[model samples]
Target chain A: MSRQPRASGYFRTSYQADRALVATRLERAMLVLFVVLLLAFPLFASAFLLDLACQVFLASIGALSLMLLTGYAGQISLGHAGLLAAGAYSVGILFREVNAPFWITLPVAALVGALLGLMFGLPSLRLRGLYLAVSTLALHFVVVHAGAEYETRRGYSTGVIIDPPQIAGLAISDPRAWYVILLAAAAGTLLLCLNLLRSRTGRAFGAINTHETVAAALGIDVARGKLLAFVVSSSLTSLAGALFAYYRGFVSVEAFSLFLTIQYAAMIIIGGLGSLLGALLGAFFVTIFPYLIEWALAALPGAQRRASEFFAVNYAAFGAVMILFLVFEPAGLVGIWRRVQSYFLLWPFRHRPLTGARK
Target chain B: MADLELRRLCLRFGGLSVLEDVSFAVNAGELFALIGPNGAGKTSVLNCVSGLYHGEGAILFRDVEIGGYRPHAVARLGIARTFQHGELFAQMSVLDNLLTGRHARIRTNALAEMFGLPGVRREEARHREAVERIIEFVELERYRHAPVAGLAFGTQKIVGFARALALEPTLIMLDEPSAGLNRDEREDLARFILRIKHELGITMIWIEHDMQMVSDLADRIHVLDYGRTLAEGPAAAVLRDERVIAAYLGRAHARPAAGAAGGGAPGGR
Candidate 1:
């Protein structure tokens, strides 16, 4: 249950009230407004903006999953891109070989992701910190190599082409449809994460994250928690990857690179370490950042002459932004958002009194 | 059968023997104090019983041999412990920290919890009620919502104790629960200890350095010096034992000053 006192008029007298996601009338109104805006965005947005929103939604799924594994459960996994690739390939291989339907492929992709997650999580039992990260990195390389091998052996040199997923004879190729589908997936993932975090399983993850021995003494199976974190996070991540494959109509090892893993890691870090909201914000910022850079570069003087150098510039700029966030805003955008919220909440008084009734 | 028993527990860290053939038994609903000087393997015994250390001996809780079991396995058999350093989930609030103690009790699976099904919700509500009662018993209502890292040290220790109590275990192991508390807090802890024994009737194996509190609260006291049992008896008799006195106050104070050697007493080593 949330312990923070609300605005002066609201009071939570019961545990259910305290645990309710939306407590006040103002919050409920804001939520309604937010949902309305999200639903209406596709009707007014251009094709490019719709695609960008879809990408953000897709990235949010991966970022939230990563946040659950690395942020809450305290398991370091650099094999996220590998899990994604496994999901995409499961879809790619199943479709290319058997011409499977979307319904069959998605669950199969999740199962593949779960198996890979189990393999990736095994090292975590014997290792921690940097060593564990290295093991995951090695696994990522192995998965990517296998994907490359499949491409060569199958004679699909460039990549695997996945047909658009069809639901009830309707092809999900339109940007608006993709946007709505991805939005639902992202929202579902967020709700699932919230549910897990508020339950016994989530508390066990938090306790294991804080102290493994203490978690064990409290009757939490630390190894099982770690594996479950990996399996759950990996499955969600794979689902995102599968959606990404369907959205892009391609499954290629080139797209699931180490850089992609780093980008997802950056999303969690620049968003905020442990917060799910931070994951969403980070996904939006990271996905649209390159486009934002391109727009800014286009408006500068002599833009056409330096257009060829834009990729290098993007890389440099991205690194600089990540470093800045790490150095100056360690808590990420959520930290900044909280500061602003508290500033407005306590406008007249700079700080809450040290010895008052529930500051 | 004893609530907890350690048969010839021997623990060695590389070449250093921390606990050597230390045997003890704690009766049901008894407050058993394990006292020792620094590095006397007092904490090690708790670690062994809690399954943190793989000591060579039989650790039986309610006649079930749990010597080689993992910590979670040991806990599944109704054993819980509090660390000396307050190893609480620092980022979580006090209520959440205590709720983790209800992990074993909450039987809902991850899938059920993920969807937040009706059964899961009901189970959670039931556990929350029990945890609230524990918070009230520990007088931690004021700090219930506060993050554990932000609380004062003594309060954090209290939260750790409360977390252990939330397990509703048959046996609770406390490792220096009163180490850093002030006199007033220590007194309150001693009172709580007596209440936990008398009112709750839970068995305890407390490792503490505070002689006065231990003497007042402990039904039986087991003294350890250099990985060996120095004395074991009722609290009053154990405190008056010559060996226990020497272990605490040194050989010079244990005997007449004139007869004691000036240097290289066995207690000095």
Candidate 2:
């Protein structure tokens, strides 16, 4: 009798069962064990390893935001760096001009990002695909140039110095403190995104992404949904941008380049298009990737003579790895993870019964 | 009073007129058929009614003027339509596609829904039950979780129809539901359409080329040619209208009209 229900794995028999995110006991145990590992990391990790983990956490915020916009909402954007720059600059300008605190500057930056997102998203109502991307790219240049213009006019040609953000009685300059703080922020963002993807908002995004006309016919406001995607994604990205500014204790137009935007985009794509876990996995992959390449290059023969070419070699290796992923694993890391997970989960039973497909 | 009415509806795409002064009324609980050869603006009429096109003149759904409403606004007023080519979410499972039809009715906010709060969970389960009923109604049990994109063309149409039904629409507009269907599928579609009309008392505005099914099911027929209405009346009368006959076959290659052409009810009630 229960064969039809569980067909292959666990079956959802009630509303709660179907709605549960971590349905299985095994999944819950794995999650608890993972949390334990995350908590214990700071105790044993090397300084370099700790810093890399922090960077990956920070990148996950931007990556998740982009995945929400481009992946779920199906809007192409090439202006992500511009939004981040706009955020960082808002902090730079506010702190320099009015001596604003972190509390004041973060919201201001988010507002700037929202306004920029609106500006970036305007072309989307009329343009799609490459044209939309091109317009965003143009706007990115406009935003970056504005930041550069400010730097020159203010005579801070190199960059603007920012004091490490402090609470009423605490200076959070320790890498461990920063790591803990960033971990919370990244976790909060993940929770928020997971909330969005499961709700009516996610459905609207999915609808508009899949087929705008049909979504509209179903009573979804497609234009509004598209704009909201840009606004929300950009705001989160800007918040991350502001945090990055504070973390480095400096704000420079150079840091928010097109390359930074490409790295974030690569995180989402090489991670997986539509999964949040893919965003995190992608951040880890892309963040560690360059170091991995550098390590390999050093281990190879003639390493001493070619030390100057390490940066160049890193770029070539990164590009080659990206192309390999694109050609061979276009579904990104999550797809590979899923295939492996299924292989083990359904061991000895190669194919799922037709009715046993994932919901 | 009609469930839906189009009064002097005119639609133009820049220089070309798609629908010109096309007026028709569909009575509540009636299966009204709109028939014409290619380019008769049959789909345009559906588009106008669904608010995809902002045509000049008025579209009243349940006595409210909806001509200026956006697509979603019109949908909120309980009018649902299937596309000429199935416009299903290609990436979503058939179940998700149908659940989207209930978007306006799903009552949970983002936080509660994401956390799987009890109220939202209950609502989702209830709607899923409703969707499953329609799934069974359409006999799509086998393809329940299949993405609609890779399904056979005819099966896609069934998914489209089922999605439209999941709306609990006041009136459902079907565009070429029988077009790509095999004979058996077409027969099944006809039976479903009729059962919905009689049992559910839902209105239908059908655009179909399958004469046998249309003639058998339609209570009233409206014919169009070159974007203008040729005739509108009970099915048998409209089928025999001389202009309707000429519109199907140009005057240069015309045959004898329907009366001498030997179909029953020619020029009759």
Candidate 3:
């Protein structure tokens, strides 16, 4: 593999260097600093802000899985919320029925997700593009309806209440503890996704995503690759869902709606398709955006008068922002980040040479 | 035994027959050229052999029936192919593109890959070394890290060829390797194909449009006309066959001495 010489004078002398997740000492230091900041944030943050950070981490897990399926694998799904619901319901049912512990429920939720992923991925073998999306959408309704049926049958019309998960006699109810747990989960998910993307399986997904025919010709099992993407993504989504259940202390069909699915879709699309960092950034943006909008509305002159219409205004504003992103920045927030990075990276020069003849 | 053999291969799309009762055998370490006019089903033959199409016939590789196996299965049996349009993973880097060809060779499981286990990293390093050999062979070292989408068409074509070589396949199928290449690139391709046949001792089934290049490189020529075989024999004789000229070649073009010498190198096998 080849690379343009960096201004930092970092050169890889071995294949391992080329394959490293963090190639340079500066990057390694920056990653460590970033991790330190994330870990220390809970010590100083207020309860509200800490909760918001937890929400971002939860959304990030969901967004990253969605990005893996729809972004990298090119398998469209409108059933993300349904998959999330499946996870939540799995946790709720297992805990209520069998009094399953934290460790047991999470894996069960993931297994349930994998099974449902295979079922959802079946139609993908025979359909593509809009048709595949429609099938997933239909499956989403089925899943949500199943959850609703459980709620009604169990006579818990409101929702299934979940106790906070515990590990080694310590309850994860504290905001700071939840923060650490979710942070670790999110980081683990990120690492897992990164590992998958760098290997042979990931390459097969990318190949099939680009062109199934060519991928098949190149000896990639396109059908198996598609199924694998679904299974992995669904299991991850389900895990996030189970985490959401424990974190919120409830599971309700109302929580997993068509709009929730769209929000997840928007995260990947507005984050930039096929990028893990974009997924995280998109998650952060979408999670914090409501608060930003609310703060803006509160600062307005007629805020008290328009309080009842807040939800409607927020929905409309979200749509408008998504449209703006799709139109002006189709590459998502990651595109903006790259431009800023390049600006600093190429300081004193406005543009790269046409032929990439860096001297 | 022939490295690859097709017996009475037939392919149909609805009512239209794309290939009709075509059969050919490529011997071990021999470069067998499949040529014809447009829509002569030259590419189709490669497709059927590579398992992209399920043709009604017997396709044996090293005496093993491989007709109905999936593409990946056939590739696991040590067959590799390049498409007419390169068909490289457009968004992936050239290194990744080549690495995908190593898919069938990858021994690590999904769990290992997801965990980035030490074994996976070591396996990846080993495969990268193999892929690097291919890049060196094709002289694509400069473009190794660049994304395939940004490369010139000629370079992408070569990358496609290099990817097939990375498979370390016993039989490599090249579909129109010289189709869109400029003269220099074509020469480079011809040289590479020759080296593959002579140095690596790999058998090849090459679908070509350039008669000069085909005559120069192919040890045996198989000509098709409207989905049927018109001539199948030694390159010089087949090129001179009257029916072959009438159906495809149309006229007698002088065979250059350089090509004849290059073509002669494979006969020793």
Per-model DockQ? 0.52, 0.40, 0.47
In order, the Cα lDDT scores of the candidates are 0.87, 0.83, 0.88
**Per-residue accuracy of model 2 over B18-53 as CA lDDT, tens digit each:** 999999999999999998878899999999998888
What fnat does each of the candidate structures reach? 0.71, 0.54, 0.68
Write out the backbone clash pairs for model 1.
none
Q: Write the per-residue lDDT of candidate 3 for residues B1-269, one digit (tens) a residue.
A: 79999999999999999999998888999999998878899988888888889989899998999998998888888899998888888777789989998888888877799999999999999999999999999999988877777789999999999989888999999888887788899899989998998899999998887777878778999999889999999889998888887776543243354336434221111
Question: What's the residue-level lDDT of A137 in candidate 2?
Answer: 96
Interface RMSD of 1: 3.1
- What is the DockQ ranking, best to worst? 1, 3, 2
Worst 10 residues of 1 chain B by lDDT: B260-269
Write one digit per residue (lDDT tens) for candidate 3, span A42-81.
9999999999999999999999999999999999999899
What lDDT score goes with residue A218 in model 3?
A: 74
Off by over 4 Å in 1: A1-5, A352-359, B250-269
* A245 Cα displacement, candidate 1 (Å): 0.8
When sorted by lDDT, best at the front, the candidate numbers are 3, 1, 2
Q: Which has the greatest DockQ? A: 1
Model 3's lDDT to the true fold?
0.88
Candidate 1, residue A261: lDDT: 94
